[model samples]
Target: MVVIGAGAGIGLETARQVRAGGGQVILVGRNPERLEQAARDLEPIGTATFDATDTDRLQRFFQDLSAPVDHVMVTAGGPFYMPLANMDLAAARRAFDERLALTLGTALYSRDKVRAGGTLLFVGGTGGRRPGVGMAVMSAATAALPALVANLALEMAPVRVNLIAAGFVDTPLSASLLGDQLEARRAELRARLPIRRVVGPADVAALAVHIMCNDALTGATYDIDGGQQLLPH
Candidate 1:
């Protein structure tokens, strides 16, 4: 299994679960230091350093995989928390590269190597489904992710393609976005969710693993948000 964007967020947690399930995981990240630390935490697995937005480098990295990989999970995207008016065009472009372009590149470079019946899971967010003021670009890219998965699933018959539309979870990525208001935001989000609690990384990881292993599932978008997306604005 190959996990792109395997930093300390959903990607890291997914690595942990895949390892726990006896699956060999290769983590790819942009920072060598963070990648090394994550690899240590997820010992017995492999790690590689590469910028998720670097298309050429990403293609090279995927091509160098030991052999045909059974599963490829693209969890490379991060939050670009800025109001529309304040959003930086460059930063938004970078975000799209990691979120959407990376998926495109991965499919182009590694699609042939994905064994028949193998799975490709894209990790996007609920903001894509229900756009919020500060999540414009990410929301747009993620909302299109499932559609891409659906299209890929059809074109890559026998090779399943699906998406995990995750919501606000307690992770480093969320921490960075929420900042000083982390706890306060969590509380606010919890009140909105039918479950009445913050979602955990483990909560998302479990569903991701299920999608990877379930042969019957294809082009499915599993909402692992604890009913947060169902809440009224």
Candidate 2:
């Protein structure tokens, strides 16, 4: 299995889960040191450092692989939270490229490299389905991912492409963004969400592993947001 965006979040946890399942993992990310640390903890097959948006690099990485992989999990996009009025065109364009375009590139480039019946899983955002204030662009990109993967599933047939739409996972990335407000946000989510707690990386990772192992699941977007979509804003 290859885990793209294998940093300190859902990507990292997914790598851990796959490793726990006795599967070899290859960690890919833009940060060399971070990828190295993540691979060290998981004892992955190896680690590769490169931006997901680089199609040439992604293709070469797969081509150079010694053997075909059974699954490719993408959790590559970063956080972008700003109202349309405050959004910078350059930033929005970059976000779209990173969040959506890169995902498409990875899927297309790895289509043949992935073994038949293998899985291509993407991580999307819950805000796509339930958009809130200051998340217009983010929501737009997130909303497009499921549709994109659905079509890919058809085009890629037996390859089994799917997406996991998550919400407010309590990851290191989120903590850094939230900073001192992390606990406040967690408390608020715990009170508001139907699950009464902020979703953790492990929660989403478990679901991702399930989707990879379950042959019957494909061309679908599974929501694992602790019922965040069920709450009233």
**What is candidate 2's local distance difference test score?**
0.86
| Residue 164 in model 1: lDDT | 87
lDDT accuracy of residue 190 in candidate 1: 76
Winning candidate number (lDDT): 2
Candidate 1's TM-score reads: 0.91
Model 1 per-residue lDDT tens digits across residues 1-233: 88887877788898899998888888989888889998888883577898877889988887777788888888876666768889888988777766777777877787877899998888877766666787788677877788888888888778898888888889888887778999898888777788888888888888889888889999888888888767777
- Residues 1-233, candidate 2: write the lDDT tens digits: 99999967999999998888899999999988888888779998888899877778888988788888999999987667888778788988887776776777877788778988899999887775566777777778877888899999999879999998888899988888889999999999998888787899999999999999999998999988888877776
Q: Candidate 1 — worst ten consecutive residues by lDDT sum?
A: 123-132
Candidates in order have lDDT scores of 0.82, 0.86
What's the lDDT for residue 149 in model 2?
91
How much does each candidate deviate from the true structure in C-alpha RMSD? 1.9, 1.4
